[model samples]
Target: MSENLKKDYQLCEEIGRGKFGTVFRCFSLVSGDDFACKSIDKRLLTDSLDRECLEKEAKIMQLVTGNPNIVQIFDVYEDDSYLHLVIELCNSSDLFDRISKRTFSESEATAVMLPLMEAIAHCHILGVAHRDIKPDNVLFNEWNLLKLADFGSADWFLGGKSMSGIFGTPYYVAPEVISGRDYNEKVDVWSSGVILYMMLAGIPPFYGESAGEIFEAVIRGNLRFPTRIFDSVSPAAKDLLRKMLCKDVSKRFSAEQVLSMSNSCLILIVLFKVEN
Candidate 1:
């Protein structure tokens, strides 16, 4: 807990709420800059493990703070009853809202993904794995640039080491994770592929009425690019999705590889525009 937090910021109206706490729009008393402040109630944390998880989230946010593609953390405040996280204020809504409002064109979806992949690659370079990468955690700034947010499930991953846990949203969980197998950062790549699929097709590739059913589907890895929705999608984009959504972790593309492939896809799009 920082001593300066109380003196430095003024909390405004609540903007959002979750199981842990409420998020408020805040302003820095010194700089007059607006930010988002997440207030987590200490009482809601059932045990020491919960407290440790919250602290870990804050540390991971601090680790990846500089990138424009990720939301920046300004400070953390803790008192007897609550924990506060002062972070970048993104005025625009999350990706889920945008997708619900209307389907994104393939080009528009690619544009959204470019910066996202960059952020993921940056996190990987720093040895951080963002286990949760759903549309709800992907926000757009006022400029409409995508910024990855919500690091509550993030963890530090060392190379060649496997993390064991069935963590992550059911629809986007990697097959290895669903099978309760040891997994690494490639889990994020699987989630990214699910995001890309939903962005293009306007639905998740693996979805069920219940989490258990979704887990089964994920483990089965039954992927499809239905002609009704994906017929017009470029083969290059589908290829990338296949590589990303691969059931085998060893075959999945790394964030860096995805970025490189995305660059190639962008080039092809440009060439087609020029030729036509």
Candidate 2:
């Protein structure tokens, strides 16, 4: 006997907080399931716009439900003055934590990226954009798979039109976004490049003292990879980075093109070549 929604789900502990929400690890009283509840205050949103963001989060999550790389948003319920997102509790810490410890092995990167690329590529096919694609937004350990979480900043690329109101984290944003130009799927590619760079080198290519500086660096293509830092990786890895970090939206790689090479059936192919 599981109560759907009313009081608390499982009562684990407060995990983290962002500008707009708090994350909790809770176990379901019903069916004994575990879940993560992100309780976001409607008032905390940057604009009075979160009503739409919350609704969009719920709706987009429903579309993203069955994805192996997406956190399953179970329900969005509101009582007197609260909005709760009941999501499948993705157990592992974020990819950022992993990088903080050690660089990902080639196979490890492949395992992580494969399903994630599938999910994002599918999302694009479905006409959605996961505007935020930072390592902090990735969760693993639920069946040892990378589950893309936090669609709070998502935007639907609806009806073949470009929508405005800037979205995405600063470092992961595409150059076009930084320049305030009309952009699309290429934004996702840029973020994916940053993610892959982090995976291989244990940090994002763009570094800066301030947010604005980071935006400038990304837009100016001011990132440089030390041959020493990338010593173990391959030239193809650099090629991938070049394609993803292009300043021109028209010059960036598409997810389809990125996924097709596999270079050895594993796209992004990692920095190391482990035999044939």
Q: Give the per-residue lDDT digits (tens) of candidate 2, residues 1-276.
A: 124454546657888787777888877776677787888776666566667887788888888688777888877777545677888877777887887899886667656666777778878888888888888988886576788888887878868778566778887888777777777866887898888888888877887889999888888887678888887676666777788777777777777766764345454343246442
Total colliding residue pairs, candidate 1: 0
**lDDT of the structure predicted as candidate 1:** 0.88
Q: lDDT of each structure?
A: 0.88, 0.76
All candidates: TM-score: 0.95, 0.89
Pick by lDDT: which candidate is best?
1
Q: Which ten residues in a row have the lowest lDDT in candidate 2?
A: 267-276
Per-model C-alpha RMSD: 1.9, 3.1
